[model samples]
Target: MAVNAHAASARTATARQPRLRIMVLGLRGVIDVQGGIETHARRLYPLLARLGCDVEIVQRSAYYPRERRRRGWRRITLTYLWSPRTRIAETAVHTLLGVLYAAVKRPDVLHLHAIGPALLAPLARLFGLRVVVTHHCADYEREKWGPLAKAVLRAGERLGIAFAHWPIVVSPVLKETVETRYGIDATLIPNGAPMATPRRTRHTLRRFDLQPWRYVLCVARLVPEKRQHDLIAAFQAARPPGWKLVFVGEIEQGDGYCQELIAQAARDATIVLAGYQSGVALHELYTHAGLFVLPSAVEGHPIALLEAAVYEVPLLASAIPANLALPLPRNRYFPVGDAKALARQLEVMTQGTAATTAERRALHAAIRANYSWRKAAELTSSVYRNVARGGWQHG
Candidate 1:
């Protein structure tokens, strides 16, 4: 049977006829380039709009003066003074603004993206608005919080999970955590990446004057948990001839860990600190790299890993369950946080172009066929409609 383009376009047009006005309460700052949640919003927002959902990512006003912000200093002093619940007050202000904005602007469905905004879900419902929340992280107890603070955080997480009309989780791992720990049932919607073109041009690599097929790429935030310093050290110790390591991400203050990474990089010319690259630059780096490595100790199924899979750069990633869940070969994973183990894995991938063209195409097809923003939007729309019809029940 032959299908007509005209009819298909018409069907697509009609299928998206119902416009869903949605306001997404986001954390990691709307413009923060370093966080995964922000990257997810950036990729999904336009697609949501195309799917007939009016999406707005709510952000907070800068808490400090311009000079301090420019110098990599956060307003931690002020935030610390707020004591046991600094984020609550900060997030409440944003949520209040979001709720007020929603009341006036009147979005049909209000979606909250992180734990902070889940604190406002009950109020959003009280104001006669439909609510949705996406849980983006693991148990707060896993974080470095004090005993009293962790207890409060855990309680708050349970409340947020138990009260939302629809709670969407990013992985089966997170789904289990929520169900067992908070007794909240959630639908698992894993992370995805936009289909990327392979880098066939020298233009992108030329910008940094890097040699083609000679550098390994690691794109992530420069945080302790990300274990980027491990990548730096591994690249240094391996010191593979004709191979370099490029780190692409921005660093925050007080973490002061960026300096430590730079010092480690100084011992080897192969390691380049490229800071933050986005849009075309980021895509190009993923496309042109010899291999992509992720040394993260913890992640919620990172989008970078998906991007690497899409571009068919044989990934040498952590041995974490999330990475294991992907269809990559058993040889791709290294024990988490072991630089030497990571170096050994890198040696294997860098040996030669071992992956066949068919394998590359298969991996790309796997990600595109199984995971996409269009499919995400469809599932989300169905969930929203179901919740609107009162089918969704929270714990």
Candidate 2:
């Protein structure tokens, strides 16, 4: 099956092409926040447009207001669809509407970003649209989901793997899981990070009273599996003098975990909750941080970790299989959820010298080579071409 798909992709690559019309669903919205799927779509689609594909992303009207929304970003069109504001209903309802919209437009490909939206893969196929599903992560593993929600997400994963013409997995760990569990040879396409460093600025740092190379940074949504509480506990235990801990993400509405985090942060003046930030502000935080930490208990392919590698910031991450999969030294990893180990590592990092110049240069080069947006775009376009040629349809 893999060989045939590759052959078809090769044929399509060589042939003169028409503009491949693609409709993307399964993101809250783009060009604003730094959610993994949103960031992926924002970066990938613009390059897809440059490669001569006509891309349209379906965003939630609740997240992106109709009055404030733009017509498009770069060469990709943005279509606003209505969904209920609740966490459980938002992705499912938005995807149902987005799939219906795709049916009306009848694009050549319906690209689904995550498993929840890929629940409608069969419906999309029935609409005569080829489907491509990007399995971002095991959503069921998240601590936020209830029993019913986990079951739904598990079913969505099954349906997506069963029905989509081309399934893409973002990490080797995920690819292995899909193959072993479902016997599907999904394509492996990792996420990417831009190589350009943000211009260093004192403005964002000044707002928080932070100094360059004197704060630890973690940029992820304030959710349970991210283990921000564990990070906070570690920082408190370590008691690294003269340095601060900063979190650069926002909490979802009604998330009690976030309130807990807020209370935890309140205990220490050195702990700063910077909230959601992007563009120059986000880049400056990444650029100036003394250490970049990803204490996530779960991940697909972390874009933040990749961004840290791109900036060549020193990293200290949990030793999850996904986090360990990246090219980092053994000394950088600590046991998952082990606050004591993390505190020990934090103390060492805060007191120790920075990474050598040669080490930083090598880290940047390795990351750029391993994860390139251009490479991801080309590979994805190849899959789109193959699917358009009916390579995996009803096979």
Candidate 2 ranges with C-alpha deviation above 4 Å: 1-15
lDDT of 1 by residue, 1-395 (tens): 01122223432653756766666775544343567887777666666565555555555445333443332112111111111224335655666677777777667777787676676677777787777888877535343345765665566566667778878888777788888987767887777768786656666688776887689999888867778878877777776778888889885544567888777778766778888887778778888888888888778767888888888877788988777777777877899889988877676667778467787778888887766765665566666555655666553
State TM-scores per candidate.
Answer: 0.83, 0.95
Residue 93 deviation, candidate 2, in Å? 0.9
Look at candidate 2 and tell me the lDDT of residue 116. 92
Which 10-residue window in model 2 sums to the lowest lDDT? 3-12
Q: Residues 1-395, candidate 2, lDDT per residue (tens digit)?
A: 45335533543454567879988899888878668898888788898887768998888888766678998889889888899999888889889999989999988989998889888998988888889999999999999899999999998998998899989889999999889999988988889878666666778999999999999999999999999988999999998889999999976666799888888778789999999988888889988999998999888898898898888889988998888888888899999899999999999889977577688778788889899887788778888878887876333
